[model samples]
Target: MPVTMPRMGNIHIPFKALFEGLGIDYIMPPPNTQRTMTLGTKHSPEGLCIPFKMTLGNLIEALELGADKLLVPGGYGICRLGYYFKTQAQILQDIGYSFEMIPVGVSERKFLGIMEIVRRLSNNAPWAKIVSSFRFGIAKMNALDNVERKVHRVRPVEAVRGTANRIYARAVAAIDRAPDYRGLKTAVSGSLAELDGVARNEARPMVVGITGEFYVVLEPFSNLDVENELGKLGVEVRRSTFISEWMKFSLFLNPLGINEKKRVQRAAAPYLNRDIGGDGWESVGEKVLHAGKYDGIVHLAPFTCMPEIIAQNIMPHTEEQIPVLTILCDEQLAKPGMLTRLEAFVDLLERKRRVAAGTAKAN
Candidate 1:
């Protein structure tokens, strides 16, 4: 099987590392682009969320490029994501697109389930090799995310615009070529060091925490690259979810009794009494946890994403008092319009900060 999976941010970096280390044959389709979106939208059922359409598009593009085996991550949850792989496969079959789907149901079996998926991809490679590849893959994932964290901080504070992004691009390239865990670490360190070398502004940027549906948070194209735009406006961006953290919870920690799910559930408290599907529960908890540390929170979700829509509605009712902005995204969103909304939000935050400072001084 020539394995190919949908692209979400830099997920392919670690995915490639894992497959190669296990001697599994894999192919990555071209990076997601407008062409991919257009194709997906054309074939997609109306009213489906953007993530569904996007991943369906990714699979179709990969198949057209000679990919025979497709891997689409799956889960069992209240969200429609549980049905994504099945539905996408059926859609392709209906359209006469010949391909095989290796659906990895993560939510149902968690780590053990993923192991089964990895086993299939590994082509019966020795268990030792499989374990080793998993280790290396996870290390690369953490390395990539750590570099991203530094880039986020540097972006808002850099004296020269685009410096952080340039360094970040280099880091990603290095990560892709890294041969082992050690090389991945070195690549990450070198990238962060370069980012640190960028000259910084005197004033501290307002920290903004972002939370919402997982796909929209990670895929820049879906969210119109909100983080970069925020950085340009001098706002530090912190994500509510990263692949490294999510993997830790879902794969390693949960099975080992080091889970953080309970803590997040507790934080969410009365606002969301139960899992409302997707990352809705976590979105609420992330706000509560970061309320004191961040100046504001932005909830980005796909159009009609029920979990995030529920989370967004509950946000204004939270007692945390942190300002919240909800941005619903789709193919129709324009960059200029998104930027204008962002600028208005930034202005509001700045005014609130100034007013708070003045009141503190008066007291």
Candidate 2:
């Protein structure tokens, strides 16, 4: 099938591992770039979200690179995502690309759907082999998130601004080489130890929690690598959701008697008691959960993303009283303006910090 899929942050690493272990021919679309965005922007519907545009771009890039089959996540549920595959297929065909689209509808069909896709792609491999491959992929996913979490904690405090990023890239490469859980553990621990060796800085940087749409949260291209930019600004960045952890909870554990979704719902209960579609519930919950810890919250979503728009409106009413900066991205090159807003937000947080410190001294 020469399977291919759009890149989503560190997800490609684990997926690469999965395809290799499945004994299947696979092709990874080239890393996202301005060219990729431009290609998508040229063909995409004007009002579609950034994620949709980027994934379509990724698909086009993959096809250009000789990939003949596409593996896109899908579901039938409370969002437009459910229709992405159908629409995307029509678009690809109209554009004269000859490809097969495999919709892995895990959310709607759950285990059966995933298994069916696996069974088809695995080329009649035994269930035992498929499970082993899946387990290894899951391990790498967890390890990737582990290293990412450390990056979030260490970036702002590193004596050298780019040290954490350098170490993290090496760490991801190491994890990508991991073949088993034991190897994954070694890769994760060794990389984390490397980060621990980064020289320390004296700055007590403000922490910022980033929450919004899942794709923007995970895909750096979609949000302009907000984490690295924040680190350069000496702000510690924490994300509310990790795809690996969420996958473990939602796909594997939830079907077997675990409920991470409910916990997020519980945390957001005071404000939004239900899923408003597409991670809105989690956005609200993250603000409530991290209010006391983060100096502020930054929400990133595509211009027309309704779920995030809903969260954006409700964020101010969150009892936490934490300030929020919501950035709506689109196909346009908005990095310069976004950077300006980020700097201003950081300055505001710093002034608030200084004023609060003076008040504390007076007390």
Candidate 3:
């Protein structure tokens, strides 16, 4: 069976590595584009979040390309994400596509659940090979995250516009093509080096932290490439979510006394004492934790997403030190409007910084 999965940022890179290592034939869905959005919007429920629409489009495209089996993320959660696979499968079936959908319930089952899914997909490969392949995939994910972190930092200061973006793209392709751990490391090192070598301005740029729904934060297409837009405005973006970090916190380190989620949840306790579903608690927690450090926070949420809606309401009540801009993303969100809001917010932060600087000098 040729397996197919939805596109989520550069996650496809690691997924490709894993399936190849396990000797499974898989189809890589085409990159998210206008067509993908249109297909998903046309078929999906009116109130479903943007991630659902986008991933549905991905599976539809993959099925059209002869993929017979679908691998989708699933689990029990407060968010509608838990129900996405079932609804998406039904929609695909109603549209006349014949395929088996496998839900890898990693959120509910954690590491063992993930291992079981890998084993099921591994074509009876030995346990040793399966573990090795999974490790390699994880290594690629970490490498990708590291390279992206560098690119985010370099983008705001690069002397030549788009220099950092070009380097980052090449790095992603190189990482995706890497056949082994050594090659992955080399790709990351070379990419980071290239980013470091980019000529940069001497002036310090305004720094902003991004927090919100996981899908919009990770998938550039869904968020209108907000990070790139912020970079273009000469703002350093400190994003709150990364796939590797999420995996490590949710699967690996939580049991061993290292828990990022718990720490954030503790910080959020004063305001949001309960898990309000999705990343609402984490969203508030991040703002509380990074209050004075970032110049501002850009909260990206899918239109009609309840968790983020709750977060958006509660964020204004939190620490007054940092400004928060909540952007509701959907098909109707236009670039011009988003850019205008971002510009206004950045200008506000700049003015605040100047005032603080002058106050300090006067004192």
Best by TM-score: 3
Query: What is the clash count of model 3?
Result: 0
Sort the predicted structures by lDDT, highest score first.
Answer: 3, 1, 2
Candidate 3: residue 278 lDDT (0-100): 88
Task: Report every candidate's CA lDDT.
Answer: 0.87, 0.86, 0.91
- Candidate 1 accuracy as TM-score: 0.97
lDDT for each residue of candidate 2 in 1-363, tens digit (9 for 90 to 100): 588999999888878887899888989999999888988888889899888889999999999989998989787767788789888899999999988999888787765677678768878888888888877888898888988999988898998778998999888998998877888889999999998888988988899999898999899988999989998999989887798877866666565675766776788898888777788888888888778888999998778889888889988997888889998978774889989999999999999999999999999
Superior by lDDT: candidate 1 or candidate 3: 3
lDDT tens per residue, model 1, 17-65: 8888878888887788888788788888879999998888888888887
Please report the TM-score between candidate 2 and the true structure: 0.96
Candidate 3: segments with Cα more than 4 A from true spot: 254-256
Question: In candidate 3, which residue pairs get closer than 3 Å at backbone N, Cα or C atoms, i.e. clash?
Answer: none
Ranking by TM-score: 3, 1, 2
What does the lDDT read for residue 262 in candidate 2?
76
Model 1 ranges with Cα > 4 A deviation: 254-258
Which sections of candidate 2 miss by over 4 Å? Answer: 254-258
Worst 10 residues of 3 by lDDT: 251-260
